[model samples]
Target: MNEKRRFRQRLKDFDLTLPESKKEYNRMLFTPVAQVYSGITRVLSFGRDAAWKRKLISLLPEIPEPRILDLACGPGDLSFLLALRYPSARIEGIDLNTDMLDRAASNLARMPGNIQERIHFFPGDMNELPFNDGEFDIVSGGYALRNSPDLGRSLAEVHRMLKPGGYAAFLDFSRSSRKHTGRLQLGLLSFWGRLWGRVYHGNPEVYGYIAESLKSFPDQAEFLRLLEGFGFSPVHYLPRMFGMLRITVIRKN
Candidate 1:
């Protein structure tokens, strides 16, 4: 099979949609190379990813001990940060990738014991989360929303998992008005992702598929409406890094 066909097959196998679910994405697509690929992508972003997540956390709703859910919590960065940000709150990290979950668990384990106690990482499918209805005060995704098998379904799932009046933060790539910057950033990202995937014995198909997926991702207005359709009110978005990425926040009514 060709690269596209293979990637499509993998996506179908894992139930990933256009934005591309890293969790359902092939284990061979990552594996031991997961850490290396993450490192390379972080370097390519000039270390902006974590800072962006931090900023999003800072903007979270002012609730005492909000229960936060990190969907597709690859490597547990957002979940770990939330744990530290709200030490008294409950935080859960869920991903479909067992290997990635293992890595997340390992990273969490190395943290100071107290911090580790505040966070939990488990395998979860975004389309049908395990938690009961209205269990979380906040639900967040880091670059995971795009790959959801059904964006609307995923949003509904997040909404259902949140308590009434709960809020959510979804950060992912976007088609920025600054076309030149977006193109350059994407080109550099593709090059490094593919190169390093090969270097670390990862699936190069994933890199190419990501480029294609980004090209086909929904624009800001469409995404906002999707959130609104899921009963999210007070929806807002902040385009970041010259519009190459964006973070959308929606409050559940």
Candidate 2:
């Protein structure tokens, strides 16, 4: 089969609602677009991608000699940012996508030795992390939660990996509370994603997964409740781009 047909078949065969299927689907979906993911994200967000990420990093509280994990750390943007923000901190990034990890490695090589020494990127899944319990001071992910095959399990892992009072910050597309508004946001995102997907990859479905994923994601209230259930307390909540995107910071109790 051709590239497009193969991708379509993968999309058809995998059901996003199932945890394992979503994991496999994401691997297939991201491999082809990993190289252009960062650039395309900037375009799709109308140049707000970097600013949103910077804000997510800024929301994190200060910690002395912190150990940080950037989950779903595609291209290591958040990881590198965390290193810069906390020079004394040790940063590790984990992602399931090997192609994205290669891109992150390339990005890491261009940094100065001091920064390079403090940051590491590896292959791992959020639902099943390899770290010890209470191993990190802070955890951050950009556009992370929505992509999780199992959101609650991933949040549980984050809570498990964080020390008492440690913070977990996430930036992702949010579903609005109002039904009409939610539908509008989904439509806009789907159109924008597909437009860029076709432009860059010659397949509209390449990025259309964003809206599909968001459909199953909980809105702000339910999201906060999930955090509470996982023994996290909300620290800060900021909505951006008319509530289509949100940055949430929570502390593990």
Model 1 weakest lDDT span, ten residues long: 15-24
Please list all clashing residue pairs in model 2, or write none if there are none: none
Candidate 2 per-residue lDDT, tens place, 45-157, comes to 89999999899888887789999999999899999889989999999999899999999999999999999999989999999999999999999998888999999899989
**Given candidate 1, what's the lDDT at residue 237?**
79
What's the distance in Å from true for residue 203, model 1?
5.4
Model 1, range 110-136, lDDT digits (tens) per residue? 999887888888877798888899999
Candidate 1 runs further than 4 Å off: 1-28, 176-192, 195-203
- Total backbone collisions for each predicted model: 3, 0
